[model samples]
Target: MHKDRIWNKWLFKVIGLELVKCCAEFAASVDFKRDYLKILLSDYLPESDPLKKWFNEGLKIGLEKVAFILNNDNQLVKISDIIIDEVGLLTRNIIPNQYIKEFVCTNYSLPGITEQNVLQIFPGSEKLKHYGAKTLSQSDLKKISSVRPFSF
Candidate 1:
């Protein structure tokens, strides 16, 4: 039992570190997508249109500032902090507890379990294998939530 506990501790630590790395990469990918979309839209706007031109210039400057921050060795940490705070601000609201319970029921939350059977299946797998899990971005979740009755 002691050996098993030690192994579980080691497993959890490794899993936690990998999850953190995956989350960071996911956040970076999201930032890249946002910048890429802004740049592409800026290019599509006609230069002759004064309003669009102004918007384009602003977008370009914003992109350059982001690049500068990302390129600097010392700014990476600060940028990470900013990203975390901005995400928190952008997504301050969480799914309400009542809505979550309803969603879990309506969406096949765990595929084969339910509130009624939860107790029975609570410890079905004591020694679980790590087959990996899919990672979704906030936008992806938003798209999914839009399709559903609830919004995350």
Candidate 2:
């Protein structure tokens, strides 16, 4: 049991690090910037606009579910909220860099928010919190990962 606990801790740390790295790479990509612009435009623009239609129709990505077992309670919890929180933090850190800012501005013309007002814009966690993180039993975790092969 003690060995299992130590292994789980190590595993979660490695997974978390890999997740952060993947997010960083995705955040730096042109596709991410385009998707960001689409979201912004879709939210703020008139419903009838063609760009809004394009955003609604063209950019839906399926959610990837990740679950973690809590050490204290031994309850499984979906960690999407934690990932969302971390992504917000990463975005905040990345956007301030002059090179990234220049690249975004040079490539895209955002509505309302521009290069001059860019510093003021940040992704809000409240918007990302569509659902509260859910706690699950070990059995529930098994059922979820059963469809896909479960791995350590």
Candidate 3:
């Protein structure tokens, strides 16, 4: 019926707009947590704090994941890739979000990619199909601090 088509179109537009808003919100949250962790580790925390190491490593992993996502030219990333379900990487010193804490704590090793694997995970392949870099550059990182999440 004509009414049905009109209603469906309206619903679809509303849902699409909501999905975009949700994606933006999710990206902002990721950036916020990364920034918060950096400030806590570098400024507020003392050198002697036993939890510093764990926090530092966790932050490193998080940043690496961000690099991986951006380097791949992805609009959205999977939570499973970012958050592992391991048991030792996390520390109680400064617990991050519930999911992130569990992801780090349970994973046996830090997420890593070898030189060969880097070509596949990020840009800069031998074929020159993508950008010429193995990881997110300083400029890319600086852009993350800006209002726009994606500058590349």
Candidate 4:
């Protein structure tokens, strides 16, 4: 696991890479429509990646268009939404929950949603295999919430 390379471990940052990998394996099973991909590009891609941005954006647009079809907001309160929302939290690599939680606290209340539920919301690391290598652990969880997500 590239534990050192990972900044926090939020999965959204790496979703694009993972989706690309899946395009090769289960081309039909996934939900990326060419149109949706284009929309994703114009909306989600950062302006700074330069060449990579160009390549990835073009590819996604084509991939979406090639499918000849495509399809596809947030007052995230609660750690679950926070975890899922801040997934961009790991843009380059893993993101620490500490960084993410602050955002969550701002929008959502902690009274209802708990950490265990939040962890459940976290997509498995399996989907994130492409971005650096890393395994999740209890200590890593600490990087997220000083205490457990469900420490009620």
User: Each prediction's TM-score against the native?
Assistant: 0.22, 0.25, 0.21, 0.21
* Model 2 agreement with the true structure over 38-127: per-residue lDDT tens digits: 222222224364444333332221112433212123222232322222333223552333433333333333223222222222343233
- For each candidate in the order shown, give its overall lDDT on alpha carbons: 0.32, 0.33, 0.31, 0.35
Poorly placed runs, candidate 2 (over 4 Å): 1-3, 34-118, 124-152
Model 4 scores worst on lDDT over the 10 consecutive residues at 70-79
Q: Write the per-residue lDDT of candidate 3 for residues 1-152, one digit (tens) a residue.
A: 23335555455444433433343344457654222212212221232533433334443344333433221233334222332212221322122333332332343232542212221221112212221222323342243335223322
lDDT of 3 at 72: 28
Instruction: Report model 4's TM-score to 2 decimal places.
Output: 0.21
Candidate 1 vs 3: which has more lDDT: 1
Number of the top candidate by lDDT?
A: 4
**Candidate 1 lDDT, 96-115, residue by residue in tens:** 43443344345433333222
Question: Candidate 4's error at 141, in angstroms?
Answer: 2.6
Show where candidate 1 strays beyond 4 Å: 1-4, 30-152
Give me the displacement of residue 7 in model 4, in angstroms: 37
- Could you give candidate 4's per-residue lDDT for residues 81-108 as a string of tens digits? 2123223333323455554454345434
> Model 3: residues >4 Å from true position, as ranges?
1-25, 28-46, 67-152
Number of clashing pairs, model 4? 15
Question: After superposition, which runs of candidate 4 have C-alpha atoms over 4 Å from their true positions?
Answer: 1-100, 103-127, 133-137, 144-151
Please give the distance, in angstroms, between residue 35's alpha carbon in candidate 2 and its true position after superposition: 5.5
Clashing pairs in model 3, backbone N/Cα/C closer than 3 A = 86-105, 86-106, 86-107, 87-105, 87-106, 88-105, 90-105
